[model samples]
Target: MVYKELTGTSVRLPANFTGKRFLTIIALNHAMESSKPVCSDGITRDISAALIRNVTLEHAAWTETVICQKGLPYLLQSNLQKVPLYNSTTCLSKCNLIAETTLADYFPATHISGSKDHDISDFICQFLPLYTNETLVYLPNDHIVLNWEVEESGSQVDDFYVGLGLDATEKDSPSLVDYISTDRKPYFKHRHEAIGSNELFYIFIKTVNKAGLSNIAILGPFLIDQTPPQYKYIPRVKISEESILFAWESDTFYDDEQTAEINQLAFQFGRLSCV
Candidate 1:
């Protein structure tokens, strides 16, 4: 699949996810209740959060020491004097060896994301994600605005596409999925998922700067409608931005297993979005 620019010509930077740290990997495992400790980077190892943090802290100190040694060469003057007989190339090689050794110990504990020999895990990194909150507001002029709260992740969120269909099976393709708008903004006003209740609807999202429709996320199998049954227009709250004031809520967020299932179904319609 080819990436068709739906917003504009310029490239938008992806959202930076907090899960970049080792702590996030631990959190993800805990959240998913997985026995195997692994990160999206494909590094699988049984490790504790405390150990990881300690290793990270140690690595930081060691790095600082290395920087200090580089800035103040005098710190190694005594050693250099003893090794005066050694050539400059030998000295440089020894320094490089020390750095490699020091890094080898602590790097594994922190940089467990992936290795050149290993492939990245999609389930932990790409598949398992947190859901963001959305707010619905009704203007006095009958204008409806959906404030979609984009959640933070280890990946970048490019754009979101809100689509309405008869069922999950309907409009399975990104091209077929009813898209209203595309942007980096968390809020969508012109078109949203809350359109009709007679059919199922969904939200399709894109993450990363990959080509085609491979990295797009499919969220939802909702029954959203503009005017809910006997729905009286409620005044918008001016307090917190957490509350959603939409006509009705969208049911795109699902359980882990169910979400995987829904996502699989959505991927089946990939042909529509892929070139």
Candidate 2:
């Protein structure tokens, strides 16, 4: 039996099996258990099942056949429905587009932080189309709006103007709000009540140009009741009777991103004498 450390699953095989066959058996078992047959690594469950179907694996071969026929028939049928087909004419046509446009870095660096009672807002997140040239007048003017949804609640919103208002809410759903600014800065301010543990809210930005074409950008998921980060502590060192001692607060008081500078200052102070 081979044990998988990550998923806590095991695969039992004949004692005679070793090396590549042993590896294959483990991969197939994990795929069956996890249902995630696709992986970045080349060794995936689908590939393992395919090999087992064609090759003879002693006693394991019968088990693989039973699994393929019974355990995965529904999944295989669903997969077969998604296979794309192209005719000779469509495949022969020359493609003009050099590269397809994508929202690779659509998320902004800023994020909303703090608790429900003191919800803090980040500056406006911005996005631009990959293939657009701003200097061209015919490109059309674009307007952005804040969008949000409730996590695990299947609730959605089309778009909202910049500014804070209790615009959208439903039974068992997150209340949708926005903060719009007219000072020429494109950003939305979001605020909400305190959330319980495991509660989540999803927020994003959507843009529509004058041409009526729309594109969406995500700000990622937001969680509630997260422990607020503490301010970093600077350590102080003291030496007496050839023994050295360091002291600092156990609780974090300040929350800043200057960890490197704080470390430098601590090290510099440690090297100095207080006698």
Candidate 3:
């Protein structure tokens, strides 16, 4: 059957039909002209119908099943496709098929709409810069905690992938090779033993939405130092007639030496009573 109008039409089949039936839908841009005689010229012209460029086809199928005692109609499959309607004059671009959703053993009372209104640009604008800020805190036993605050208004986060690498500017694909995958959470714990001590590392957080769109947030060139400072040599004390001096040498990690500095010296003495 052919549907000429740009509106939906419902067709009922015979009750005796039991095999699978195929349906084809086509959307045309211009209305087809009738073959009736309009002009006095004896020449005949061929009229062709052009198809609309951006055409989307949506279909849903279901089957009735008798399980136990109740007969329920379960949704078999539902799909949305951007029909690739192209002619010799115009070449249409290819687009990835939007994600599909399957409902089993049940169907909604009303029609469910797809994300056709939400375009790629809208999706990026709403979900870009996934997090406002991130925090990394060091813990004992070569462990650390990472936390971040996500934007309140946007697509919900589906999963998070945490990556630790030496190169902060590395691309997402290679950096996330050895990563820890987790669900939607504000914080993630990672052990530093795998990276070793006295080395700089960067933490990358990748947030993914239900539609598979992703954004990456990078934090740090953090230096992992589990080692503590130690005294290089024993302190030397020199007592003079007018002054007392004390000196000592110590060894500390490079990162610690940059921040920890000795600014003051204190000496405590006890009073002696002479007979």
TM-score against native, each model: 0.24, 0.25, 0.38
TM-score of 2: 0.25
Clashing pairs in 1: 1-212, 2-212, 3-212, 15-156, 17-153, 17-154, 41-113, 136-245, 136-246, 220-252
1-275: candidate 1 lDDT, tens digit per residue: 11222334344433343233232122224365634543344322211121100111110110011101221111111011100111233233334443222112211221222311112222222222211211111112212333333333233444444444444444345433456545555444443333543443444443222111213333334333333223134323343477543232233333321212222212222346434
Kindly list the per-residue Cα lDDT of model 3 for residues 1-275, writing each as its tens digit: 32334445654544343222344444444576434433333222212111111111112111111111022211112121111111111110111111221111112222224322334223322332211112122222346565555552335466777777677676375352366786766567765566655555566667675546666655444544454444445567799888987766543212352233332344555586322
Find the candidate with the highest TM-score and give its number: 3
Steric clash pairs (candidate 2): 162-179, 162-180, 163-178, 163-179, 163-180, 164-178, 164-179, 231-253, 231-254, 231-255
> Residue 102 error for model 1, in Å?
40
Given candidate 1, what's the lDDT at residue 107?
18
Candidate 3 ranges beyond 4 A from true positions: 1-6, 9-141, 174-177, 236-275
Q: Which lDDT values do the candidates have, in the order given?
A: 0.28, 0.26, 0.39
* lDDT (Cα, 0-100) at 82 in candidate 3: 18
Best candidate according to lDDT: 3
RMSD of each: 30.9, 29.8, 25.8
Q: By descending TM-score, how would the candidates be arranged?
A: 3, 2, 1
